[model samples]
Target: MLTVELGEELLIIKSEQPLKVLSSAMLNPGIGRYQYFVNRTVDKNYYPEDAKCEYEQFLQQYTMPLQMTVAMMTAVQQRFVMREQYVDGETTIDVFITAGLGNAVDVTQSYQYTYKPAVGTINIFVFVDGDMSDEAFIQAYHCIIEAKVKVLHERGVIDKQSGTIATGTSTDSVALAVKERGEFHAYGGSITRLGALIGKGVAATLHKAIDGYDAYQKGELR
Candidate 1:
């Protein structure tokens, strides 16, 4: 079973079974300055010695619960936090995003200037209730990335060269949780709807984050 909690300054996901954190980025410690923030906030002692070196265990034990708090407290804090719940008949998809863009950039301009190490970070977590296959997971990931880039572009945060999202290092991350089915094993039923909902939710959440960035730039928000 999967559980969610929204606290005064944190959002947490508690699960009975171990969940996977899958992304091309290095979320184990995050990237650049974001990496330092995660390292400072996470309780390394939380994990057993045996699991200390394991990335997945570290996330489940440390990052998932503590990173939110850390992001909230950091000086160049995360500007936006959004959560969306999508329901289609019996299936449900929940999307969560936390964006920190202090190192944001225009992908087009990346090549022109010798920039610093890591770029901004976006943490996306998706929870689903349904059965799915490995292939479906890959395709769904593609959908999430596309939607994220689209939202960045629509909100005027794209790279000048790529015309997509600004290029970054191993900072962005994603966590996908799926529920298991009973005796009769079947798949491919929820991918399409789940993908659509996840995409829309992620895009909308990112837009909100962009709004915060705009406000900060205008000195309306801190």
Candidate 2:
């Protein structure tokens, strides 16, 4: 099973047993750096305590109940009034998304503003149960990416050959946690379930985030 806990700044994803974990993030130069690596999970200590503490402190300065956090949680489940902490995939999957669309762009007109920097970024983390091959993992990642772009297009933020809606952002990260040695085909049999749910989760979340951005830009969010 996978465990997901949403903190003020960080999103903690872990598995019940030892599994393989891969994480990547594109961060700004001054905020800090995230080391990329592929490692087997023997225990639940994935992130460093000190860095985690600093992240929380940094997050406190922002407004409470972050819109990104709310969007992510809301994607997987309906209703955000009870401070609900998770979206259970019935032990099959767990996904989380964080969005900051301050630098959002219309893929068609991004060339007009190439020199400007993005104000924020989005990070998504996913956890899946079952033993999967390296190929399967890569395929899953691609599925998630495809879903993200599709969502952006659905909102008119992206168009055919218009590039990406998150062009100027510094970080758009994805972390996948897959269980080790399980009862699943390792030779590319059935990875659709994993990909499909993740796609749905991301699409729903990104739609909400984009909607929020539109509201703010029109002076309706405040």
Alpha-carbon local distance difference test for all models: 0.52, 0.46
Candidate 2 wrongly placed segments (more than 4 Å): 2-5, 26-91, 105-113, 158-170, 181-191, 209-222
Ten residues in a row with the worst lDDT in model 2? 73-82
lDDT of 1 by residue, 37-115 (tens): 1211223122345433443444465545443322212112432456677766566777767665655566556677665
Cα lDDT for residue 175, model 2? Answer: 61
- Cα shift from native, residue 145, model 1 (Å): 0.5
Q: After superposition, how far is residue 5 of candidate 1 from its true place, in Å?
A: 5.1
Candidate achieving the largest TM-score: 1
- Expressed as tens digits, the lDDT of each residue in 1-222 for candidate 2 is 444444433344434444455555322111111222111111112234564344444445644322112111111111111111123243355555545554455545656554353344445655565666777777767776777667755665531234555432333556655665544534322246556666666667666655665665687755
Stretches of candidate 1 above 4 Å error? 1-11, 24-79, 105-114, 158-170, 182-191
TM-score of 1: 0.63
How close to the true structure is residue 93 of candidate 1, measured as C-alpha lDDT? 71
